[model samples]
Target chain A: MKNIFYITILIFIISSCKKDGAVTNPSSVDQTYTPTPYFIQYPFYWSYYPVPIPTNNPLTVEGIALGRKLFYDPILSQNNTMSCATCHNISFGFTDNGKQFSNGLHGEIGKRNAMPIFNLGWYEKYGEINHRFFWDGGVPDIESQVFGPITNPIEMNENLFNVVSKLKSNPEYPSLFKKAFGKDTITSQLLAFAIAQFERTIISYGSKYDKGILSNFANFTQEEKDGMSIYTDIYKGDCWHCHTISSHFFTDFGFHNNGIQQTFSDSGLARITRDPADMGKFKTPSLRNLVFTAPYMHDGRFKTLEEVVEFYNSQAYLGANKDPFITSDKHEAGLNLSDYEKKSLVTFLKTLSDSSFINNPQFSKQ
Target chain B: MIAIKKSWYILMGFCLVILLYSVSCKKDSTNATPAPNPTPSSQKYSLSINITHFFGDSLFKYNTKFINAANDTIKFNKLAYYFSNLKLTKDDGSVYAPETYFLINFDNSSTAIFQIDNIPQGTYNKFSFFVGVDSLHNHSLAQTGALDPGYGMFWSWNVGYIFNRLKGNFGAANTALTLDVGGDANLMKYDLPTSIVLTSNKVVNLKMDIKEYFQNPYAYSLKTDDSSIHDLSAPGISKLVQNSKDMFSVTSVQ
Candidate 1:
């Protein structure tokens, strides 16, 4: 009886200790801890860049933290007054605060409006005609693209060499660089890589519209759903040709001549490709965050989404080089939607405004 | 007696588990079942290519002197060129090609960071690569990555990617020269498909010398006559025609 009592006590101690003890034995409940946040997790399917990703620059928590800090640091600019966040504000769906153009160092006004960055990783291509980046589409690839604002007198106003030297001067950045990359020294290439990694994480895939399409969602209002129907109609209000809406990234990744202005001094694709026929063409930006990214068009000519719709309705005047898609009609006659249809479209566009992206502490100015 | 029997059973079970574990560990350490041994001496090797520039007999150092049109002396502050589409040919006549491969912006770091993985270890007889944009990336809005815009390699106004950007200043004349060449006027207008082929075959141990290019004076000369600047900001008809003509060359196997 005494032996039995001792055996019972031993078994009790062993089983109770297991609540906090480390054991290799398989259990009914999951013991392994895997905590990937809602924002940073990879999509179900994704593609990589053309020039394959260096194994060293694989995305990681430390790399992203360093990148976020670099992105917000004004030290990237010459005068140390402006950063990428100056133009790409977090509150305004990663765009300037509905401004026509953003102000740079020494208060220099840019010619083109700042573009809202979202789901950049999913884009097979960027810029007009699926070019790399920029309103004029001058730079190719993200690595060289960062050099633009850094070197531009009107933008960052920092010399490329000077910028490198400044980054090296920062005691914090070196450690961050070492954490992200093995080495502590920061190169423009490495800096760009880190920034790209952070930007790639800025996915707007959790919008009501996203959920609607993904889960056959009914979270949105009846008007918003009606607007989406009009927006998706291929022949009618077919905005999908350029602003594609798939279950994943919500863009067709194409350029279009959306007849907004008569004479494009900007000469977007014309500036990049040097083809006369491509005159007045601009990249078709995604309409995912249109509600927050106001002051529409490349030059920020339109103050509101209504004005943008009106311009598209009028099919604003463009000359012989104009795209055949934009008919000569004053407005896109094909739309032929009632006032209610227009209201529904606006409501649906609003559903794309995700509060989570704005309020997420992770992306905020930490 | 029953207690003794129960203790013996537990001890036996524990001993059996420990014995299985030890056997498993030993199996892992030694090649327990040596099945299908890998072929020995089937060699695989790697070769690196370093691209260098030359002006005549000597290396083409950046910020060095060169004569342009009208006998104007000029020196380059920055002299870099783009080369892409590397193809490696082995002695067996097998070719290994890197897809969508290109190299630009001559940094002190790695060059043409493409890997010719799984190449059967053999002596490569020849190395080849295109010196300019391939027909694919040259397509309208049909590119990404290093092929994206704002590299200052594109003519925004003219709607064409500048195939090359050769910038420098004439020292004697105190004039600056900016030469951006890449586009076919024939393609822009009548779609005649006027494209030039600039390819080179260099023996690869581990480096590609562009020195042969600067050695030939007539092949690439700086012009400082009227607009020595030669800035093709926009790919206008004149700019397109002039730049396309100036920025290209072909070299033979070394």
Candidate 2:
């Protein structure tokens, strides 16, 4: 297999040239190993139907670096000071600065508004597939959705066996849980498969409008190319039939009722499928760092994107399971846009702000 | 000496072309595909399912049998519930469903036992699953498994989907039927659905005995901090069509 990947990159460039004292012969580290040709992969958002990594929790880079240090360690919470980045925040891009509600741990609050943990390992299943996961989708696997904010007594009240005995009384977490589970004994199903392998590496692709549409760069200027031809008109933003944007996480993850809320005091996705045609559905986030997440729906309550484009340009009263492309008037669900096309569609959604995925030093934690 | 014997015959013909390119990469590492069937068949088996708690079950506890308007018998202290949509039929109607299925949260002391281990050999029979939570995931939202409302099954200011969850304690007439069956938003838009089919494979190890279903002769039980055994957490329609006809049924797969 490409000479054992050039003898495992000549044993990690002869152990990084003997941890940098440079050149420690072994035939000059096998002539500076240049054998990078071997491809036989598969297992990155894996799915052929209801199956993805369950041969004893496969994916591991030391389990995404011990699930990115238990997702930025608030010591799995019970007032250790709240973590999963305090409702997912890698500088507003991982999301939460919008807050129509947030407060957890004693100050308590939280009814919704946190969404933005990026790509989510290419999502085949996890909420909106018959709703389940807060914002009332309820919950079901993304490793039991981080066990409802660690036993939520208003979120992160801890106790999955005392967060597996405070991750086996950490001393560098029992050799990083024995190098990601060869047995250091910290279960809760290996901390939900190392926080679902650091949330499938939170891949957002690298935006600036996806490298200016994959590369011809510097080209989008007629009002950000007519707001990307009116944001892919599936008849004026039938919004790609559930906020979709082609491939990997722009969101077709489903659930709607873009007419946010009206009357039904919180029956989102009709309270997890006892359907009245799913009164006030939700899930459809991901516009990809829509200029750093936002106070959008699911109760973050439109803090601005021009008040969610004037509430879809007044396609207003969407009660009773709306969405026939927001009651079809050729996708003009409310686009009366002319405040300079709402500042050129919020400057083409700030070219989908990557900012190196909010400064990714390999999704920093340490 | 003839230029050092022609440079040692070009370094012994470059070590015979690196030993014929390491024997043609050991014939392409013998074209893979080894490692399958990593031993696990020391013949040990036990698969059982038996959970029946019905006292008129729903329609607001239909047929009301956890008794005590002076009828007697209500002895439950805590009975854990939650069955998921699972199907494994194959008498040639071919079905194997597992988009996601989990049963046995019943006060999770390591999920009592809904055990399913590597079963591969061929078979011939039936096995359909889904005691509740289907209207495509019962009113969709806030779920974990057993439709989580922190596994109090779910109702939390009412949404729907909690099908038949029974809680405990009712002796000495204190009155506790805590039977949290499910539905509302008009029976999640009208009811009349219930399923459970079984006849399984890999040999007859399927025994579903919740003690022969509370020995039913119109027998169902309940009790737990009883204030008329407070129908678990208000499931309306007397606990959705009487706990979907008093908790599911389909015994005998010996």
Candidate 3:
């Protein structure tokens, strides 16, 4: 009789416990978590430029924290193996360290070269079409563009619905989502918004280039100074036309054909617009953090800055859709840069690398 | 021998569960179903938008041959676009904005039907909606459903949405034309003025005929003419987009 009674009690106990643990819902009153606004402070020197903070997604402490976690979480990947940081390493100015192409889930290589994410908050509309993010200029906003890699077949290869379902199932993510977005429920919009908020806070103002060139706080070396002259002066390098050194971001943020090919393997902007005239046109990447991010260009063709400079000096093949400004009065293969001039230009590019920005703790994975 | 298996242990387990539940799952305020002054349990308004494709009153069957301005015989692979910020207008001049965004893709039968639920049953006169996302949601990050950039409708480089995308085969094998339109955020928006009386039947069948893209006020004849076919995009784009003004209409009010 005692054993029968015990079995009945055990049955009741297990049955009652099963339903109790299943409730994941947060009631109406607990849904409200106050978001503390985190203001992004800009350097006084860059006041002239517009910060690309979206009016809808202002930065918050909780949001930035959640974004940081998500940015580093491999849970965003299809196989739960790759995170955004897998390619965009914080040590390498948020670019893949010396990788020609980033590795994705199941050993799939990325389609394009990984871009460095720094001072993206200040990247703005330049020239005719105001394009931002990616070499092809496919998506417009940084937040919206976050969908690119996660769903990209060669990248993370995970869908937004799956990402949501996965994040919702995790015990910790729901509360993190609540702290950032004011509810326990998770959504893709909030995921992108939080990640973007964290990315915007990756400010790179403490570079030696900033102090030595822009602020005149540190003295520039003679080689660095001479290189800076070639970089800025229209007669020598003529690079200032596209990558203007006058701006704090050091990029005009315009798309260019850049005299790279004779026959197009990559249609570049043409693929996006379906306009044949846009063949070989690509967004001009920011020249900052060259020390860490190697194998340059949309395809990461050059292994070093010397190779990139040397290619532009003579080996550049201006295809059918080369930009007009890449040539002066006469059509030439390249800039025909003198050997000394090329070295100086390369030296100047190295000064833009910000070690302080890469080492900052706020950007580090905790 | 275990002496009734100590029911107090089960009681202790229950206490521990309650403690953990209190910490993680807040029911004091959050889980409470805000039942203050609950409304009458009336069934909600069932609003559904049905997309019907046509090639000038002839039903648009996919894979059917059609000639383009570029003189190429073409058949559609897919047609997808966004419909955002749909609002039902009442007689009081107020609007009931839906929390949903619709992406109508004819290739997927599921996408062609958009059923909206939990809407308040009322007498709505007219509905206001946009064919593309506005500037606010367009540039914002990681929007789901219709606005998700993963749908291949977003422009990442320039930060805009490709309001409408048309993909199909061209004249010869291996030749194709992808006409992406509607980044002109200033010009792409269209407002529908059709009257929708939502009194007797909560269901409204909104029909979007693809052939209407060719003409309503503007004839997109440039897209069909063979002589103008050499030009890839410039021939009849403006004509087609301008014709978008008459795309959506109230086909049924039941």
> Which lDDT tens digits does candidate 2 get at residues A281-348?
77677787777778877877678787786677664666688777776665444655567766676677
- Residue by residue across A1-366, what tens digits does model 3's lDDT show? 556755665565555444344443444234455799998776776777758566778889999999999999999998898899999998887888888888777777876789998877765444333356678776566787687788777788888789989999998999898888787577788889999999988888777788885547346778788888877766667777788677757778777898786787887877666778888999888888888888799999899999988776677675577877675554375666778888888988888888888898999998
* DockQ value for model 1: 0.09
lDDT of each: 0.59, 0.57, 0.72
Best by TM-score: 3
TM-score of each: 0.62, 0.30, 0.69
How does chain A of every candidate compare to the true chain A by TM-score?
Answer: 0.81, 0.33, 0.87
> On DockQ, who's better, 2 or 3?
3
Stretches of candidate 3 exceeding 4 Å from the true structure: A1-32, A125-130, A214-218, A274-277, A318-321, A330-337, B1-100, B103-141, B144-203, B206-251
Candidate 3 i-RMS: 10.6
Better model by TM-score: candidate 1 vs candidate 3: 3
Best by lDDT: 3
Instruction: Order the candidates by TM-score, highest first.
Output: 3, 1, 2
Model 2 CA lDDT for position A184? 40
Poorest lDDT segment (10 consecutive residues) of candidate 2 chain A: A33-42
Model 1 per-residue lDDT at B42: 47
**Native contacts retained, all candidates in order:** 0.04, 0.00, 0.48
lDDT of 1 by residue, A1-366 (tens): 546755655565455444334334566456543222223564453433232232534666776777788889899888888898988898998899889888778888989988887666545343333365666555444444555666667878776556668888877788778777666467666777777767767766567876676567577787887888877876546666567665344555655677776777778777656577778877667787788888888899888877776566555675646666666342346456677877777787778877788766778779
Better of 1 and 3 by DockQ: 3
The candidate, 1 or 2, that scores higher on lDDT is 1
lDDT of candidate 3?
0.72
